[model samples]
Target chain A: MNLPAGETRELLAAEYVLGTLPPTARRRVERWILLHPELAESVRRWEHDFARLAALATPEPPPARCRRRLENFLKNERPRRRLTLIAASFWRYAAPLAVAASLFLVVVLVERVRTVERPPAGIAVLVGRHGHARWVLTMGHDRMHVVVVGRIALPPHKSYELWFEPRAGAPMIPVGLLPNRGLMTARLPAAVYVRLAHAHLLAVSLEPAGGSPTGRPTGPVLATATPQAV
Target chain B: MASPPEPALPSPPPEGRSEDPLAAAFLACRRQDPRGLEKLYELLAPQLFGFLRRMLPRKDLAEEALQDTFVNIWRRIEGYDGARGEIRTWIFAIAHHRAVDILRRERRLVPTPDTDLESLLATAPPETAHEPLAQLEETRLRDCLGRLSQDQRRVLFLAYYHDRTQEEIARRLGSPLGTVKSWMRRGLLGLRRCLETP
Candidate 1:
């Protein structure tokens, strides 16, 4: 027996707002809310109703120092945020220069590697549904390089996150977020390096900006690749 | 045709109107104004703290949740969509979520005496209270909640007020987990049907 989709969604939404859903399930529901506006509305309505019920708890004034602590936090946080904004602006201006430099570096690296023909530790070419290579990942001794091959149509407010599945039906461990364009280089974490040796497949999923919130993929798997040892 | 009338004096906001007083302060906080955060803290801290104190067993834990909730409100204010709900709901949701997180981490129960179920069933808002519409809504909710079976009501209240998981509620009531889940589902459906009645 199965519940109608709407009823099931409503129940899930209620449970989500009630704080009854387990942590992983809760994260899944949050992602569902993002993908489904109706679910979001249902969750919001439940939140409003429960918030009203929560108001039934008698109101007792918090100690005065709580206020002082918050004020102090804000005082410290403001300058830090301002500094972050300044750094953001610096990135805004430096982005084009950095892109140019990276492009040049890519060209030089690709040529030198082709001539040297040194076997990469491992390599994988992630392909889209059409079987066209979308990204090429190469694991060197200590660094992993992910380079977008062509114009990949990326959804707005979404990023492509990479993961290494150690074996069939095993927990997928997050490797890194893939760039929409150009190249991303990161020093391989020891765990990732160890997993790469036995990884069954490499996968990419569409996630919100900055990557998966739940430490697991919560969106559609857009591409996948199998590592080949040279 | 007549002489200019005297300038209209500013009148106080209407009584009994359900208006969001925190909306302006929320907007300012979104813009990173420290003063706006101060105003919000002044307005909401007491009520939020009170709610947290009830949710968490210890004063320090509740206070910790309160601070984290405010910091999250300021940082994630951009995520709040005015079209979806009120600022107050968003704020309370953050606070409630934080409290639940702490509750799960602590895994300790607050000491709630065996409450008189009859009193809760008979609960009604005081007529003298302001915000009649809100009071009416609360009354309707309470009435509907009262109608649920005692077990169902207890399960719902355990989850809602005490942040108890279904497993915990089951253990606490000596009921099977499946039974507790059914009670919760049926309780929720019944409440929804009652509240949705025009």
Candidate 2:
């Protein structure tokens, strides 16, 4: 389990490259490679050996959306300390204004709901990588209601951050960090709501407990969903 | 073990070359040149996409894995050491890992087909008319791969291309678990020897 020796190590390296190793054994070998330089060399050799076979596959051009997405990701990945500082200032002034705006919107939304019986404007069921529905978001006129339908175990120090990805080439806007469980309402600002109206997809990524230190996502994106009219 | 009869494969085209540009791009990416990253994508995305397409069941899923692979490569590029292996191998490792993750996730949702092994093994490799490799490398690899026993070839193909676990392969092929493991080990060993010779 620690460090495989001799022929065993070579076989393990090959199996690892071959994708036949079980998850546990695969993790063990990966860790072993980091600790022992010789094992790493062995794995590299095996990787090169099989790489030739990879060429046998017919090349496929990825979808146009893929290039756009990668470009956007790379753009967001740039260092923007200045932008983060501006965001901090903007949030400071906007927080109280946002609270007052939400209270007024809630009253108006409540009145409208009583006057007319209508379904949610949009609904998105965000499924995790495992295909389990994890979060359900219902878009109202001025607010978005999110419900955690399934439990996503997270490190105590980590949290799930949500973003609204507009259909246009706009950068992903930070929505908010999802609570560990249960329903949480986010009062969407007019700018965000306007963008959300045109947005087709919502993305959720895992970030630090407080949320992304960077203005943009700094961790693995867990799921994405396109909201449907309901 | 006696080698299998070699198939008559056409000489590969001369267009595709080595990984030197990719390696240089990696170096530039390390220095935070965004253009270098874009160049790397242009050079490698097709090859990675091809591998992912065969590995995953759906094209959309393959695309998602491809995106994730590049994102991960960008994030982890700082840790890349050229001395360990070619950037090509490292990139493929990341992509293959991503495809396997998707497969595992999908497997959890639905049971794997028990007869997929037979069907996949029976199917021929897709024709390379549209996408040919370098002539010498292609000829050498095809000849060497053809030399492997049918069982060895099948096992290696399923393992490398489809990301099938030995246990799953055993169930799919209707063979004993131990036999499947032996086939995988022997297949890889045979391939290593065959490729090493000449």
Candidate 3:
């Protein structure tokens, strides 16, 4: 059963502050807190309450190797381009943010592919309702990769399904559920469309079973994309 | 002759930390100052590291995860919204998740001994331990902790140290999720009540 609005939120927020909420539950509540300011305020009160509990633990020094590894990682992380600043004219700024977001996951995914040694795969971009990338997809014969770097707004009672609209001669297949955080990769069928400009459309359909049913999209189209050349 | 000169003293309000320069600096780095991120790191490293050390079984893993946590914090500072949670909570949440993720990935169990309450007593630094009165307070606090039900303390410790999700804690303790959650809420409230009653 779903929880009621405020009182239950406080109870859960306290548990979250106490560091007792389940990971899934915590993720859910965190999303809710992001949307609702009041719930977040409840969390703040509890955060201060249990904040001192850490004092009870004895400090353990880390091994020197770990620090060195982290230092190296930091030194190596190339800073990506950030979104442009806001100004009196949001209209002037909107397109750039959308364009930057479109390339974001592709940039990260491409970089990761080079260093991490993943296989050549098929990719699809899941754009937000307004044409920003809610996620990006890269599918291999056995693994599906989805990177949700941009803002994704899912309906409360439903979820967005990722569908591979293969060419008229091919078939549509289910990939996997999209996450709210960093990049994700899972197993998939194979590369169906090489050039996004030429082949099947990657589309979002709101549906049940945590994904699309009836083998076709059933909800308002959120976003679609073509492949980017590596 | 004239009215007595007003006393020239304006003491800062005791509870008013309104101008949290540190938080302000975090906000600034969040806005534009890159050094602000490093300053935040310097401020928060101990708390983050100390918390992680308690949760992980080994030091190396904890430290590795802590580094990732800080790196993410530096990179994702703009995503931090002060309105949602405590800056401390937000920072630790990242650290906590990294620790949990590492544990899940490695599939390792945290090693914790059956600690005796008295054995846990840490005599503070000489400056504080030198004072018999401070020692007395520490003794009293330990005694108060000792009075807590084992379940209560376990829940409290698990929450504080491991930052386990309620589901994980419940599964580990073999208690219902609701029971585990309420224990964290009321049990912590009880501890506070007990500690504050001078």
Least accurate stretch of 10 residues (summed lDDT) in model 2 chain A?
A111-120
- Name the runs in model 1 displaced over 4 angstroms: A1-3, A22-31, A79-94, A97-230, B1-20, B108-134
- Give the poorly placed runs of model 3, Cα more than 4 Å off: A1-9, A18-38, A60-74, A77-80, A83-230, B1-38, B108-147, B163-185, B191-198
Q: Please tell me which predicted candidate would have the highest lDDT against the true structure.
A: 1
Estimate every model's Cα lDDT from 0 to 1. Answer: 0.70, 0.67, 0.57
Estimate candidate 2's alpha-carbon lDDT, on a 0 to 1 scale. Answer: 0.67
Q: Name every residue pair that clashes in candidate 1.
A: none
Cα lDDT tens digits for candidate 2, A30-57: 5465457788788888886666566556
lDDT of 2 by residue, B140-197 (tens): 6677767777787787787777777788778878999899888777777776677678
Name the candidate that leads on TM-score: 1
Query: Each prediction's TM-score against the native?
Result: 0.62, 0.54, 0.51
A-chain TM-score per prediction? 0.50, 0.47, 0.45
True contacts kept of 3: 0.31
lDDT of 3 by residue, B74-146 (tens): 6766555444455665666677668766766655564442232233434332222222443354455555666
Each candidate's iRMS in angstroms?
A: 17.3, 19.9, 18.7
List of clashing residue pairs for candidate 3: A20-B166, A21-B166, A22-B166, A142-A187, A143-A186, A143-A187, A144-A186, A144-A187, A196-A227
Model 2: residues with Cα > 4 Å off, grouped in runs:
A1-8, A22-38, A80-230, B1-19, B110-139
